[model samples]
Target chain A: MSLLEFLDYSGVAVFAATGALAASRKELDLIGFLFLAAVTGIGGGTLRDLILGQAPVFWVMRPTYVVVCVAMGVLVFFTAHLFESRYRLLVWLDAIGLSAYCVMGAAKGLAATASPTVAIVTGTMTAAFGGILRDILANEPSVLLRPEIYVTAALSGAALFTLSSEMGAPLWLASLAGAILAFGVRGGALAFGWTFPPYKARPGRHPDDVM
Target chain B: MSLLEFLDYSGVAVFAATGALAASRKELDLIGFLFLAAVTGIGGGTLRDLILGQAPVFWVMRPTYVVVCVAMGVLVFFTAHLFESRYRLLVWLDAIGLSAYCVMGAAKGLAATASPTVAIVTGTMTAAFGGILRDILANEPSVLLRPEIYVTAALSGAALFTLSSEMGAPLWLASLAGAILAFGVRGGALAFGWTFPPYKARPGRHPDDVM
Candidate 1:
């Protein structure tokens, strides 16, 4: 597989794992855990595709991602008791997925000829929006509105990627650099318990996050 | 306002009311009702915005729609218990909103110079999609996924609008014709208990819906 494709799979796997972990927190059974994981992992991309006027969505078009997520979900279900820590592993995986998906989305946006600003927004949004949707569907507050720096981290990485492209950086270099930056920002948030202030909080949590 | 805008607002009002009623079924508070109402009312439009690459979203841009939905939600919260028959009210309002939004979406797609097939799809999607998202959030099976004529009705209206537009019908007439068709189809389903047959029932109920 190409590097980009490989990274995409990695991102999906990590995100799915984190989703399963979250589902386990809800005391969900194996299938429930897998179901949530797949839904959370794919929710953002589905929204992105629908909005971009792309037909069938990525996961819908390529059902293999579905298979992978379900498989991962099944494994996590049977062995959920193994990872009973307070989200440390899941947090790390989430960071990796966030960075990886950010790079992939930003690269894809630029390839689609989006303007620099739009590209960054599209990329970062693609990276973080699905988790936000999943949280809302699961009746949890979105990480986006929590001042938790999730979107900010994605944004910073997206900006760096775009800037690197403008500076004539190669795809590999740009992606690697941007992913690191995203990981750093999000990692910092996880390690230090960083969050934005509450001025931007939506009423009773996110309104459009459900959509 | 022109008749078109009048129709649009009316559709929004009806859809919003239906959303509030749905929330009432769960015994959610006023704010929750508003959240659900606003989403069900404008969710399709928001989806359309993303597809059209319209930024910040309509409710975000206008803000009034949010106010309207919130106000309607408050109204429903107080009056919901007073209604002896909520089922009929929600269903009919849903029908009206679905019809109006379907035609409106088609018109927007046409105005954007989108391809005819795309326009038809966009129109129908714009009308019904928000409800689909709402159902997911509400932990219910999407009406679209069922053997219901919901999406099919939207498709029918969208096709009508596309054909009328191609034949050079005036915008008002075309939209009216299309919307009436959609309303008729949906109304027929509600009256006659229409449903889509299951595609093999999928072994067992996917336990995810239980949550």
Candidate 2:
């Protein structure tokens, strides 16, 4: 397989594992694990394809993606007891997936001749949307609501990739730069528990009181 | 406009209103109301179009849907306090939207020459996905997990529509039957608090304890 394709599959596998871990945490049934993993692995790509009007969403075109998710879910279900720190494992795996998926999404957008802004947005969405769906399915507040610098990292990677490609960088060079930048930011956050400032509450202020 | 076109627009308006109400309950700002409303209004149709490989998503192709959502958001933001029971309003509006969207989705699927089963599934998705998404964004537990017999109502309507179409029923007649069936079931659930049996607990039996 080409390097990009390899990276894509790796990202899918890691994301699926994280989703399965979430299902285990929720004490959901086996079907829940498989469903969550499958959606978490491909939800972002599916949304991006739909927005770009790409027919036959990527997973539908290649059922191997679903197979991978199912395998990951079953594997995680059996081996979860072996992992001492499931939360940490989920976070690290998510970081890896985020970086790779951002690059892939940007590449796909560029391949489709999307504008730079649209391409970057596509990349960010591809990286973050699966996790969002996973959290929703599990009835947890999404990481997006945690004041984390998560989507920002995906945005940076996507923007870098789109900009590099626009400036005539080779595909491999551009992807490498994007993935490294994304991983660096995400990995730093995971290592340091970094987060952005939460929204300040205005005491006794109603949202509609002013308007 | 045709009756179907009218019903589609009405459904969009009601769904958007319901979303806005949810934002109001969450005490979100104006932008939040608009965003949630737009998503709830188009989420179902977008999913249906994507799965069916219909390009440009319905709302993207016709900006009027978005305009309607925005208007509904602003209106609700201003008038939400006037409603004494916002939750009731949301449920009633959702039921109305569900019935209309199901018939519309089934028609769209049949127009695409999809199999009867696929058409029925599409219809159910189109009727239910928006509410699922809205609940997620609002951080409310989805009604789908409430054992409310919600999806079953949507499925019955879609199945009825597709079957009638296959039996040479006219468009208007088939759609009417489908809409009435969906609305009747959903409305009855609302009026009588009907629900399905929740999964019984298997005491002390772990999901992962087995193979």
Candidate 3:
């Protein structure tokens, strides 16, 4: 398989494992594990495809994605207890997946002739939306609501990838640069508990007045 | 515009209003209200188009849908406090929109030559997924978890629409029957607090063992 294709599938598998781990935390059944895994594996790509007007979503075109996700789900279900800290693994794997997906999504957006801004948006969405859906489905507070700079990391990577693509960099080279930036930022955050400045409440601002 | 077009736009407007109402409850700013409104107005149709491999989602092609949603958002922002019980209006408007969306989605599915079961599923998704997205984004307890039989109502309407279409019923006739069924069921639930039987939790079923 090509590098892009391999990275895409690895991302799917890793995300599926994270989803299964989440299901285990919720004490959900096997069906819940499979459902969450499939949704987490494919949700971002599905949304990106729809927004880009790309017909027959990636997984629908290649059934192997579904098979890989299901396999990951089953594996996680059987071996979740083996890991001493599943949450840590989930975070690290998710960071890797996010980095890879950002580059891939930006590549697809560029190929689709989307404008630079839209391409970056697509990449960010592709990288982060699956996790958003996973959190929502598992009834956890979405990471979006947290102070963590998660979406910002995805956005930066996407912007870098789009810029590199526009500068005529080779696909692999551009993707590599973007992925490194994303992973580095996310990895740093994981290690150091990095976060954005919290939004301070405006004492006199009425909720309706802000509009 | 044709009758279907009219109902579709009406559904979008109503859904957008409901989303704005939700945003008001969250004490979000103006942008949040508009964002939620747009998401609720188009989320279901976007999902349906993606699944059906329909390129360039319905709103992207028409543009009017977004305009309508924004307008509704602005209107709701100004008039949110005029109504003493916004929740009641939200539910009734949501029911109306759900019924209209079901018939419209089913018609599109059948026109795309989807199987009856697929058409029904598409209809149900189109009717309910927008509200699901809205609730998730607003961090509300989703209607899906409520005692009111919302999804079941959508599914029943979609099934009836698909069945009637397969039987060579005219579009108007089939749509009317489907819409009536959906609204009736939803309206009854609203009036009488109807609900499906809760699933009984089985003891001794390990979360991982079911796989």
Q: In terms of TM-score, which candidate is strongest?
A: 3
Give stretches of model 2 more than 4 Å off.
A195-211, B1-45, B55-128, B137-139, B144-211
Residues A1-211, model 2: lDDT tens digits? 8767877887788899889888776665454566567668877888888777786667656657767987998888777756656667787888889998999888888788668988898899989998888877777668787655799889999999899989999888888899999999988887777787766668887655653
TM-score of chain A of each: 0.86, 0.92, 0.93
The value of fnat for model 2 is 0.19
> Over the stretch B1-211, how does candidate 2's per-residue lDDT look in tens digits?
8878987998899999999999999999999999999999989988888777886788889999999999999999999999889999999899989999999898887787456755775687678888999998898887655545577678789989999999999989999899999999888888997765432223554433311
The local distance difference test score of each candidate is: 0.73, 0.82, 0.81
Off by over 4 Å in 3: A1-10, A13-17, A20-43, A46-89, A110-124, A136-140, A144-211, B1-3, B9-39, B50-93, B114-121, B136-140, B144-211
Model 1: runs farther than 4 Å from truth? Answer: A1-106, A109-211, B196-198, B201-211
| Candidate 2 Cα RMSD (Å) | 7.3
Candidate 1 or 3, higher lDDT?
Answer: 3
DockQ of 3: 0.12
DockQ sort, best first? 2, 3, 1
Q: Comparing candidate 1 with candidate 2, which one achieves the higher TM-score?
A: 2
CA error at residue A175 for candidate 2, angstroms: 1.8
Ranked candidates (TM-score, high to low)? 3, 2, 1
